[model samples]
Target: MRIEGKTFLVTGGASGLGAATVEALVGKGAVVVVADRNSDAGAALRQRYGSAIEFIQADVTSEDSIVKALDLAVGLSGTFSGVVSCAGVAPAERIFGRNGIHGLQSFRAAVDVNLVGTFNVLRVAADRLIKRDRTGGEEENGVIINTASVAAYDGQIGQVAYAASKGGVVALTLPAARELARHSIRVVTIAPGIMETPMLLAMPDEVRASLAATVPFPSRLGKPQEFASLVCHVIENPYLNGEVIRLDGAIRMAAK
Candidate 1:
């Protein structure tokens, strides 16, 4: 569980929470395979972290790509201690509406990445983890960390599609934990509140302020590193399993 001297395979490691986790783990001496579709960012990360990190371009939505990334991970790291699934997308929609409602395609795309893609990573990584020998007889072999969203619980009016996909992720944690328990590998999810990602960061100052004001206290968007910290904690805590931890401060979104 100690991040130091271990290898972690992280999807979406080019940016946001994924990038932050890679930074934290690599900083602590953990070797990493930063798998992401964004080759530019992934390559830059490799440059920044040097030997401790290597970038792999893989689209999480494709099974073939996932397999490739997993192979690359094994090729570089020798063994993996953890798999962090941070690849996801949010597409807002309504199930039904006067203006023809949201497109089903949009909804399906969200589910494909946020939910199904997560499964691909988990299934692939857990398969390897189960077969691999435990480093120490007293503890688990590996960990799988998933990303959900606050919208799963408190979705806004236009977030039906996004919420459903995230809800699937939330629902998946328990079942995965149970299934993967025998191998001593833990499965967990983090449902984050609004974070200052590139999109949010691009908003006008007053608009961003308005969004921050919605939080109950410490009115500010969550930081990617804060979410990464929770991941680091879960990695080291053996007892934490089959749970979805909310990284939101105190704020719950109002129905928009």
Candidate 2:
């Protein structure tokens, strides 16, 4: 579906990949609802984008929260055209670590926020889109874009919980797309490799550089804008659905 004149709800839109996506969508003339728990960042985005974007404090893991966020999207823009599920958490902890056994709480938190949270947003957004009147022939009602990580496929040591969470996201794509097809909604997931997000940037310079060197081409961490660009492309491309597109620079990570 064309982005211009449409509205999209972006979870975790306050920062990182989600922020880039919100900006990209607004730049393309699409109204965006920035659903995130970061009220300060959300307010800043709303102030910067004015009417092009709306900010709603939302917890993606909560059904009531996301439902309200989607309602707000429609109330602000009159309709919901798509959603980009970027709300996630990545906690690196080995099952048996220097401290002790990996905490069950940490594992549950990762899965709850990364995997289940994605589905929470998707179901609510898809429901709204499916209820909308289609613009007629060959017109898609909406699209859902989810975020995974290259670790889902090539998880290194100390990434058990994170990998499991992201792996669930990748596994969810195909079935969701198939089920939503009857309503003209598309579901796709993106598995990004090492990226220049805050989590990676927090690493020491030498460490960061070492990681960047792993990428086969470009030999650098992926940019959030590149991720956002793919999201826009996926939305506009009707034939691209039910797939997990890896945004890594051909890097197959080795087990640490």
Candidate 3:
């Protein structure tokens, strides 16, 4: 499960948590395929990392798109050893909002991207990993790291769709790991609290500070690198499987 000399496919790797992971993995001598929809950012990453990384524009909601991305990973490197699914969207819309009832399309969109999209990548990557030769003494073939949210457990107001999608991710981890055990591929999910990603940075300074004050300790937002560090640990630790690790800074969000 060591990262050195291994290959990984990182979805939504052009920025935020995914970007940090791509950089961290490459720094450890692992070949990374950056799968994202942002061509400009992807190109920037390729330019920054050179041959250590490859950029593939992929839509996680589509099976064909993810399959093609996986194929590109094999073509770029030799085999796929890991996958990190970070492609997700969070839109806050109350079911009974002042504007109107939440749109059904919004709910479906979140679930499709966050939940179904994750499964799409997992199933395809697991299949490819299963076909590969086992490397470690533990017979480990691959690892899957999915991104969830603390909202899955403690969703606040205006997060009905977002919470449901993340809840599904948290719920899927154990069963996925159990089923994929025979193939020696591990599945794990990370439920992160408020983090200092691009999405959060867009908020006004006062708003961001208010959000930071919610964390009991550290009193600041989580950093993307911290999340990336945990991912590295999960990859190197074979026994760590089928579990959801919370990277929140002891923060339990309140209903807004």
User: TM per model?
Assistant: 0.96, 0.97, 0.98
Q: Between prediction 2 and prediction 3, which has the larger lDDT?
A: 3
For residues 197-218, write the lDDT of model 1, one tens digit per residue: 8778988999999999998767
Q: Write the per-residue lDDT of candidate 3 for residues 77-110, one digit (tens) a residue.
A: 5556989999999899999989989999999999
Clashing pairs in 3: none
Off by over 4 Å in 2: 136-138
Model 3 clash number = 0
- C-alpha lDDT of residue 135 in model 3: 48
lDDT of 2 by residue, 1-256 (tens): 7788888999999999999999999999899999999999999999999999988899999999999999988777445688999988889899898999999999999999999999999899888888876664646888999999999999999999999999999999999999999988999999999889988888899999999999999999999999999999999999999999999999999999
Select the stronger candidate by TM-score from 1 and 3: 3
Worst 10 residues of 3 by lDDT: 130-139
Overlapping backbone residue pairs in candidate 1 total 0
Candidate 3 lDDT (Cα, 0 to 1): 0.93
RMSD of each: 1.4, 1.0, 1.0
